[model samples]
Target: MRFISRTSSDGVTEQLFILGEIPGVLWTPEDAAGARPLILMGHGGGQHKKAPGIVARARRFVTEGGFAVVAVDAPNHGDRPKTEEFAEVVARLRAGMAAGEDVAPHLATMHTFLAGHAVPEWQAVLTAVQELDVVGAGPVGYFGMSMGCGLGVPFVAAEPRVRAAVLGLLGVDGLAEAAARVTVPVRFLLQWDDDKVPRAQGLALFDALGSADKTLHANPGDHGEIPEFETGSSLRFFARHLG
Candidate 1:
């Protein structure tokens, strides 16, 4: 995405276009100082870069938390080609329900999609930011909600540059290895009543992580609650570690 335009308060008015084969908007303040921490946000399923409230959250990071934000619309979501075949697969998985089980195949497909598209896009974005000397190329933070978190963990572990993590909404997977390898602080917020996300998965991830500074917070909410059940707590985690 290339910088296009911006004019928000707290110096967060600059907009850039992320020129991917898949494009997106990078709305960040023009700050050369890498002193500010960053949050690279991954989009949720069926949502895009222009999805509701993402920019507002980005603005909050800029105006209040003193962080730069980078958010992307994941593949097949938000400004990308809608792959109905993928949706049909999800429906099939839903139809074949089992005891103590929900939709796992859908999530598995999500992992596959992110591995191929979103993660690479994020890596490219991080590289681009470094090349531009944007915000002085400081350490970054990762915040992935829902399937976003599933993608974020592996990215955090693989990138080696991400300094902190907020695994929002989504429980955990592929985190143990990352946690053991990463010195970065990690915080997980698992909502109690999340229908789509299995609770045990989160617990397993929490137990598996070896990071000394890892934390797991359980609050009441479903998968839909935002900036409240877990997002704000996420901001606070970024503030503490990334700040």
Candidate 2:
């Protein structure tokens, strides 16, 4: 890993780190040292690691929640170069929809392709971050939604270091199998009127979680309209579980 930039504010320091092709930011509290609890944040589709929401949450996790935070660009998102296959998938899906054809098959194909890479990419980021030694062997947690949740389900299931997770804004179809393997404490968020994801599907995903300690926070809104209060609730959840 190599340093790209460093900035500090309000007793917290945020640094950009690049690991070969993967680029991400790390947030550490002032005077922090060895083995602090870490939170791995995942961004939504079309959002980057440094997106405002991600940065804000990272800052909160480091400064207020007293944890180190890291977020990497998912495949085809953020600063990473887009794959031709992903672009083609999007074009095909759009063309199919415009032609009044059912796009469920296309959607499934795309989800499978993305999920295949997303899980391993997250594992790579986690491995890289752990090697940095800034965050010790403390408990690890995850926070993600939408495409993040789509990928996070499998990642949390496969990564034993993640002790808890906050996932939501997703459907259940492609992720249920992974969700069934996630035994970590989870706090799931659901937008009641989500247009991109059906409420029933979101509930099904929540129900599929193997976590004995999981809580659902359902609110009235569309996919992008998650209330600030829900974010606060998630912060508390992480603090309770990971802190």
- Give the clashing pairs for model 2: 35-136
Candidate 2, residue 92: the lDDT equals 93
Give each model a TM-score. 0.82, 0.93
lDDT of 1 by residue, 1-243 (tens): 466665555677545465665565555564535445767877676676766667767776776677777776776677667678767755655665544455655576556655566667788887775555455577688877777776776677778778888775654444456545555688877767777777787676666665688888877667775435355667777888766
The global C-alpha lDDT for each of the candidates, from Candidate 1 onward, is 0.68, 0.85
Q: Show where candidate 1 strays beyond 4 Å.
A: 9-11, 29-35, 83-101, 172-183, 226-232
TM-score of candidate 1 relative to the true fold: 0.82
Local error of candidate 1 at residue 119 (angstroms):
1.9
Displacement of the residue 28 alpha carbon in candidate 2, Å: 1.1
User: For model 1, where is the 10-residue window of minimal lDDT?
Assistant: 26-35
Off by more than 4 A, model 2: 96-108
